[model samples]
Target: MNTLTTIERRAMQAISTDSGRMLIVAADQRNGMKAAIKDAPNGSDAISREELAEAKADLVRHLANHAPAILLDPEVALPAIVDDGVLSRGTALVVGLDASGFETVDGLKHTRFVPGVTPRTARELGGDAAKMLWYTRPDRQGLDSRVAGEIRDLVAECEAEGLLLIVELLTYQLEGESDEDYAAAFPQLVADGAALAVACGAKVLKLQYPGSAEGVSAVTAAAQGVPWAVLSAGVDHETFIEQIRVAMAGGAAGAMAGRSLWKDSLSISADTREQLLTERALPRLRELAAVVDAR
Candidate 1:
């Protein structure tokens, strides 16, 4: 049997309940949240940084109660949420290490890390785990090697700091690829990405739903027994619930999801957003938690 380090155990326990399944709520979105808030009714085309930070904090204050772990952007929500005492005891905090933009290199998109917040820094900031989202395209030459090296370096940093490393792997279409084609190819892409993350030393995997039981099974197998969870990918609430079921049935430990749980808040007035989150979003999270426990 594989042995877990002390920090690894703590990190895993933070994300999981006594049942050992992780029902995590992710609000680490940056660009997408800005767009949603800007596009809301009577909303501005540009949302100030301060406004965005407050919005994210509000999300944490309301949603953190529903999950064992809350994934947050360190730059936007961490300090405020910590100061506000929003995170309940036993609720693990996972901080995002990647920055806001994607870098296009040779027609494929690559993620960039935020400056000065390495795994060690994240640990110093009281993060139970450090998360990074990596864009992958298995068909592209040399991209895999570059991503592997990046993961290796991050893994070493996390190990040195004794923090858990959660890698969220996503794939983008190659230039000229149609949206339909990309959607159809996503399952295989996720499978390949999961294998790569495991090989490169990811302690936990936050992955997009693979769209089918078989696809989820394949991706889980590729994880090589490492704990893996599904992301909501901004799907509708009901759809995301089904996704959690399928993923857990396929051997995923649980889910780390956002957008689907709270995106509706963006369409309403700010005054009413909290009401909607309570009425619509909170129940969805409870239902997903039930699914994870059931699995």
Candidate 2:
């Protein structure tokens, strides 16, 4: 088993249940949030930066108290959410380092970092840890090596600053890739991505569902000793709960769910947002937490 440094251990504890499972609420989306808001029935109004921040704040206010940690982006949910005291003192904060969107190169996706949200800056922002979303395609030649090198550097930076680094790996289909081919490869793509991240020194992971119970078990084995949590990837709440159950049974630490939890609140009134979150999202999260705890 890989032994954690003191700071890594503490940060991990802060974001996990007392039983050591990571039951986190992820609100660290920018483009995804905009899309959710724009797609809402009442979402005809022009979206503003303030609206994004407010949406995140609403999520935190209603749901942060229920989870062990909340993953937030540096752009919208940092100073104001913390400064305004909307975030609960009990929940640990994880600042995201990935910028909005990605660059498509040679039919593969490449990720970018937020210029100002480095490990040191995340720490200064009162973050217990930092997260980066990396686009992975192990089947592509030379891509894995390049991305692995970046993960290593970021891991070292976080270690120097005494902050935990949770690497979130996302696999995308190549341009013109067939749906059947992509579906067939999705399980291995996720499994390979998790193994690459863990080998590159990532201490924690937020991974997409690998598509089956067998694939889930492959991820757990590939993780070695590093703890990994399943990301929601915009799936529906019921689908995500089952994913969590399968993942925990396969040795996953827990979940870091986002759109699956609060996607409905994006287009609603503040009153409705609070009401739905309190009524719908909260129960969904509790069910997820129970699944994690059952592990």
Candidate 3:
């Protein structure tokens, strides 16, 4: 890992609260939102691209003011959200560079960058920083090298363009891996993944809960001074709140969350959606911010 550069430090400050914590609201989801909408009470498989854009716009319009920053995808929410004035001037933007889904090769997962989306493109989209989601399984044979190479290359690319990168690491259960066994290994996976990403020059991280307070401490230690925020992972709001509390108590930087903040607002009537975003989601964000602020 390397020390933060002046540009990187500025980008980090841009996304952080006045108190200097990352309390980011995320609406970068594409496939995840589509699935939630399809399963929602009023949703159908016939969902349109415009609907997804509007949904993302709604999230930014309603909640952007409360949070210091919002995470959006280059696919739907980028230039438009910045051009349309939906995002507050005070709110910093972090654009997602990874594609919506991954590919499976021999029971392992692989990630892809969105075509034409580089750090320069993200900057052109008015992004203060760029985030890429990378799935890692260092313990698996043949994966460690590939994963490390990709992360190191990405960090170099971002540095070349003077853009800050937030590396989001996710781990999945392998083929023939039992639920209990995977669960038992979750903490080490997250900790080792963080260490690997940082070793590859990742200066910041957005990661999943390591399943225990002790696990959270392990990740914090592995980060080697890089800031790491906790992602919601689509858990329920209450559960996510507790997780954030535990994570911050264990020295997490803060959070970059989605579903837990506004999943219920999807596929509903306009009025109902607005109400949920305002009454429920907004408060949830504030409460989460409060947790980080308290820390």
Per-candidate TM-score against the hidden true structure: 0.92, 0.95, 0.95
Q: Give the alpha carbon lDDT tens digit for every residue of 105-223 in model 1.
A: 77878888988788877877779888999998765634357888898788888888888888888887888999999998889999888888777777788898888999999998888
Question: What is every candidate's alpha-carbon RMSD to the true fold?
Answer: 2.2, 1.8, 1.8
Q: In model 1, which runs have C-alpha deviations exceeding 4 angstroms?
A: 1-3, 38-44, 141-144, 179-181, 266-270
Task: Write model 2 residue lDDT over 68-123, tens digit each, in one string.
Answer: 99999888778899999888889999999999888887777778999867899999
Clashes of each: 0, 0, 0
Error at 110, model 1, angstroms: 1.0
Report the error of model 2 at residue 23, Å. 0.9
* Order by TM-score, highest first: 3, 2, 1
Question: Candidate 2 regions off by >4 Å?
Answer: 38-45, 141-144
Kindly report which residue pairs in candidate 1 clash with one another.
Answer: none
* Steric clash pairs (candidate 3): none
- Of candidate 3, the 10-residue stretch with the lowest lDDT total is 38-47
- Location of the lowest summed lDDT over 10 successive residues in candidate 1: 38-47
lDDT of 2: 0.86
Query: What shift in Å separates residue 176 of candidate 3 from its native position after superposition?
Result: 0.6
